[model samples]
Target: MALTFLFRFADDVVEASDGSLYFSVASTKFGLHDWFFDVLEANLPHGQLLKYDPALNETSIVLNGLCFANGVALSVDQDYL
Candidate 1:
């Protein structure tokens, strides 16, 4: 199913060779209005990397416990995260 929850802090997205989408979430504990603290101090490593598989209409948590994960880009050949 499609994502029913608003991402806490979706910062970036990139399309994969398989047509899936990879994105970044700055912090799950804070929104855009107050994300500064999450990155600045209050919370560290609250970021996450998500993957959306349109073919299956599903979204999965690919990675977590990241430190303010802001920008995300898949490696060439889509071999690495």
Candidate 2:
């Protein structure tokens, strides 16, 4: 299934044991081409970490206010993100 969210800079993605998807949004205001600009400006945190549930067909923001949410991964024991 194709899905879209408010964020356009989704970069890293990791799947959990239960099939949930965890991803990172680099920046809400900028794309890869303007990554330097995003960093140079030092703007307010616009990045975010998100979660997607296949069964529910829903996406939710797990965390926000990040400078640039680039990579995402779960803990070894799957106890944390």
Cα lDDT, all candidates? 0.84, 0.86
TM-score of 1: 0.82
Q: Whole-model lDDT, candidate 1?
A: 0.84
Tens digits of lDDT, candidate 1, 1-81: 446546889999999988999999988878889987886764467888998998998888898888888888988888897
Clashing pairs in 2: none
Q: In model 2, which range of ten residues has the least summed lDDT?
A: 1-10
Which parts of model 1 are misplaced by more than 4 Å? 1-4, 40-44
Query: After TM-score superposition, what is the CA distance of residue 50 in candidate 2 from its true location, in Å?
Result: 0.3
Collision count for each candidate, in order: 0, 0
Assess candidate 2 and give its TM-score to the true structure.
Answer: 0.87
Candidate 2: tens digits of C-alpha lDDT, residues 1-81: 654677668899999999999989988888878887667766677789999999998888899888888899899999989
Q: Candidates' TM-scores? A: 0.82, 0.87
